[model samples]
Target chain A: MSDKRGSRAADRTEAIMRTALELGEEIGYAKLSIEAVATRAGVGKHTVYRRWSSKGALFLDSLLSLNEAHLDYPDTGDVIADLRQQIHAAINLLDRAPVGPLYRALIGEALLNPQVAAALNDHFITPQAEKTVARLKAARDQGQLSPDFDLDLAMGILSGPLYFQALIIQKPLTHEYVDRVIDALFTGMGPRP
Target chain B: MSDKRGSRAADRTEAIMRTALELGEEIGYAKLSIEAVATRAGVGKHTVYRRWSSKGALFLDSLLSLNEAHLDYPDTGDVIADLRQQIHAAINLLDRAPVGPLYRALIGEALLNPQVAAALNDHFITPQAEKTVARLKAARDQGQLSPDFDLDLAMGILSGPLYFQALIIQKPLTHEYVDRVIDALFTGMGPRP
Candidate 1:
């Protein structure tokens, strides 16, 4: 299509996604509707359909294209310090309402729906996991971690506590747990310095 | 109420809940219906309402009454071994397809629905938490754990990683993660021994 039409479509798609995100927050995932998003976006239903096929697809797009990226590491050449900083940063994110609820809802929804699950695994988790891998690789390169430290196990170690807090504990994501987990992770689990 | 009518009502309620549970696994939480359960149970729709007020509650009763009993543990002298055994037993429960999927679905659906969430929190988590507390207290009394260790934190340390693997890793609950977490938990944060 022409440049002008492409730009127009992009704007309309963003608007629809914005509306869907809001509706998803307000009414919850089970009640989310494409029609509601179209009405809220002030776009024609056919135009909405031309882009995404269903509510799940629209919501997937909305979730994937979110602007809020996770906290990136600055690499101060200290792995332990970097991990502490990162854990504290995660605490702040989990404490934030918009980020936490959306995350919980998305994770919950993805568990049941395969399309949404695949979209999330490929689009959302892959990017974040890559970033985490880079951080761990940087530590390994600097000889901060053991040469044999598995990236996947490191992922499990760092992330296991945070996911535990969000899913099972179902309490306020406190800085205290972050401190305990981070302390246990670096000083306790890793190779003796 | 006559004894015959009361007994008939109780039987109908049981039938409806059982049917709802079976269908809940067959379809999913999203597609469960009271009408279908009533038809399958060979009971009038009103009979379902005479017990559970809605589809959610009916499904809750069905799932709740199933395998509701906690694992019975003998007062074995070794607390650490008993706790390890408990984690292993939980992993066994998670390995079953019907029990596992139904649990994840139940929790996910509970996150979306407030009433279900309340029921799940009260009926499932609270009681399990209490059982865990009892076991941990027994361990503490047996002079196994550190004197100052909080039961909640200790429990979190033991079981949190297992939940992390099953839900986040989306893997079949493995014996490896289970034993790894158990080993780490027993060692405490203080020493190599």
Candidate 2:
């Protein structure tokens, strides 16, 4: 009986988060409010306040849920294919309407708000970032890559283009672009003569 | 008589832009206003209005003048050296308090305003992006890169880490990061062994 109530509460919380994310897109983060979220979710303001003490905390939780930041770990046995999968996931993630603008606001907001930034970095950005690193390590253990390479640098190489596509170019990330970047980064940019 | 008045108007325009950029730092874009800029620059509101229809446009022009995006082109014989100079210039440009936030806000505002978005893309982002592509083409012609490279992919590879470090990391684009990225990218991601 007790467990059932807890599970129901968790479901409701999840519902609130979903509603909040929808509201974030309909209105900018600057305009997002707890009362608005609660009203939209068909819940009382007390329910929202009890769960999330601060709007930033509420926004942070809602954002993490929607942004798909700590994305799925690609487990394709082929290391290169796995990286391609990771990059592909990034492209798809950015296709979500909320992802791009929220991220732009989140990063700039993070510049001034340390707590939100810390939550985003720990629970959101760094985890997805480290997933590729871990996979690269696994590849290294299998002797798929040269022993001398820096795993971190390799991850950066894979992730760099995706971030630039999203944050800088501010456009839809495409598969064709991803394949070529992966091909080029893996092949080398040195004098090809 | 008209020539003297034109010269004075140009001086006033420059003063207003310089003042607007400076004030955006001390206050912030959210709070920035044309009247405030006029007050600080000791110019009349009509003077600003006659030049720029709105605050966003004024700020846009101010940001361009501040960054001097017009002068970013480098004709150095070596593509690598030209990019190094640009990266160094970016480092210097970002050292200013308002440049980072102002640029972020401008881009963010661009998302909401179609005209502004078009202007930013057409005038600022695309031109800057294409300049890098032009340099990459020069490199390819000189046999510095593989002939099969996609220009967009190449741009992503080169600028990705630089953008990540500056935007995501929010750290200064240090010489160390620059050198590492340039070196790793030139050699490719996987280890050389």
Candidate 3:
């Protein structure tokens, strides 16, 4: 009986998250609300509040639901290859139609709303950033990267181009562009003479 | 008499722009309006509208007002030094408190508002990108950069770290970070062995 109840609860939670993503993509984060999400999910507002403290929390979950699978931090003993795969995966995730718009909305909301920003940083940004940093540190320890490599700066060097291309310049996130970025950066960070 | 009139008009424009910046800093961009600007500047609403067609245009002008002086493309015949100087100036400009917040707001609005994005691109983004690209092309032609250097890819490599540090990571835009980024990129793009 308990197992059956647990399975049903999990299904409802997934349903609610699915509704939130759809609504968020359609209406945007600024106008997304818990009430609307609950209504769309065919659940009571109390059900959503029981799971999430605020709309930002719900939005964060929605983003994670859509993105968690693609955010693999591969450590294949080749730092360049691992970083390239990780960043390329991220670009693919962000390039999808609703996902791109969804990210833009989340980031836009984060800029204006401190609560949303904190939630996003705490739940989404920090974890991904930390994972990338940890992978770089491992690479450094393995003697694949320079001893002088600053992890934070290196992360910026590796991932910054993709972010710039996707968000600021509004350019297409192509695989060839990704290859060039990785090559340029990897060449620079290779063993110094 | 016409010259006097032109100078007076220019002065009013400056005054209005100054007031807009102050208000934008105080209340944030989402709440900033032409009406507030007109009232703050002690000018008529019609006067504000006569110069700018939309609030986004006014905001773009306000950003340009603060940034135009620093936006000069340095061409000291040294590609590395010129790019470094250019990026350093940009970092300094954005590091200012109001300017950083203003940029975040503009970028946030740009994601949601097409007109704001277009204005930002037309006035600020395109010109700076073009300047950087032109300078790089000139350097390539001068045989300063490797013939294999891709201008578009190089621009992404050069400017990406700054945008990443400022917008996504929310880290301090340190001089050391800028130097390291420039060195890494410059080393990568240097002539082959």
Candidate 4:
């Protein structure tokens, strides 16, 4: 295809994703449909279908497009502080619209749909987890964490609570909550010496 | 109502719940319906609807009926060992058929439906959390944990990782994984003193 054709295709894809997010937040995942998204985006149904096979696929892409920057972990040489900052941002994202509802919906979809689940884990969950693991490894190397710290378990510990609160209990994610989690990890839950 | 009538109603309710579970496991949640459950149970649709308002409600009751024994915390005076045993059993449940798929389907429904979410938190999540909190309190009293250890965070810490693995990453939950999480909690992740 010509450069102009390639540019136009890219634009249409972005438009469809944007419309998916907007419609997702508006009508939620259950009610939103590809046809409606295509109509709103001024694109043909075939164009949307050609790109995304299902609503879950479309929504996952839409959520990732908006969430790329939020997944990065900062390394200011203080692991706990950096984690607190990043988790605070993550919880904040879950506490607000567009991302929060969209994410929850995606999770709902992922649970029921194996295809969506695999795609979500591949594109989103695995990458975010890897970044966090990398940061924790850096901390471990720096002696900020124990050399033998279980990085796999650490990954789950850092993320599991927040996800539990937000997705399972449907509770509000607070900054204080983030601090509490970080403090628990750093201080440890074991009996004092 | 007459005692005989009440007994009959109770028997019918049990049958309905049992059928709901069977149908949920057989056909899965997304495809299972109230009408189908009623038909399978050999009861009128009104009978099913009278007892539970929705499929989620019925499934929640069905799950609780089967899962009540699994949620209890064993106070063997060894908190870590008890937790390890309990988490191992919980993970075992998630790894198998019937309960695993049914619970996953319920979670999927709960995410999209607020009433289901609230009922799940109230009936399942909160009670299980409280049981764990009570166990932790007992441990703290016995000097097994720090007095100031945040039980709420601990509850999340204990269950969150397992749930994250089972529900989010869709990883296989194993006995070794349970031991790793318990060890992490007991040993602490902080830098060596």
**Considering every candidate listed, which one attains the maximal lDDT?**
4
Quote each prediction's TM-score: 0.72, 0.83, 0.87, 0.91
Full candidate order by DockQ, most accurate first: 4, 2, 3, 1
List, residue by residue over A1-193, the lDDT tens digit for candidate 2: 9999999999999999998878878887778889999999999999999977666678767766754643666766777787777667766665566666765566556655656566666656677767877887888778766565566666457777877676556666788778778878766776653
CAPRI classification of candidate 3? acceptable
* Candidate 3 displacement at residue A61 in angstroms: 2.1
Best by DockQ: 4
Q: DockQ winner between 1 and 4, please give it.
A: 4
What clash pairs does model 1 have?
Answer: none
Better of 2 and 4 by TM-score: 4
Which consecutive 10 residues in model 4 chain A have the weakest lDDT in total? A89-98
Off by over 4 Å in 2: A39-57, A63-70, A98-112, A143-148, A154-156, B1-6, B42-46, B49-54, B67-76, B95-98, B191-193
What's the alpha carbon RMSD for model 2? 3.4
Per-prediction TM-score, chain B alone: 0.80, 0.79, 0.90, 0.91
TM-score of chain B of 1: 0.80
- For model 3, residues B1-193, the per-residue Cα lDDT tens digits are 9999999999999999999889988998889999999998999999999989778889878877876877787789987787778877887787778888888888888878887777877887778878988987888788777666666676678778887777776667887888888776655422233
* Model 2 TM-score, 2 decimals: 0.83
Model 4 spans with C-alpha error above 4 angstroms: A1-10, A44-53, B1-9, B44-50
Q: Per-residue lDDT of B1-193 in model 4, one digit per residue for the tens?
A: 6999999999999999999888887777889899998998899999988878777888888877875787688889999999988877666665678788788878888887898898788778888888888999999999998777898787778878888988999887889988888888767788768
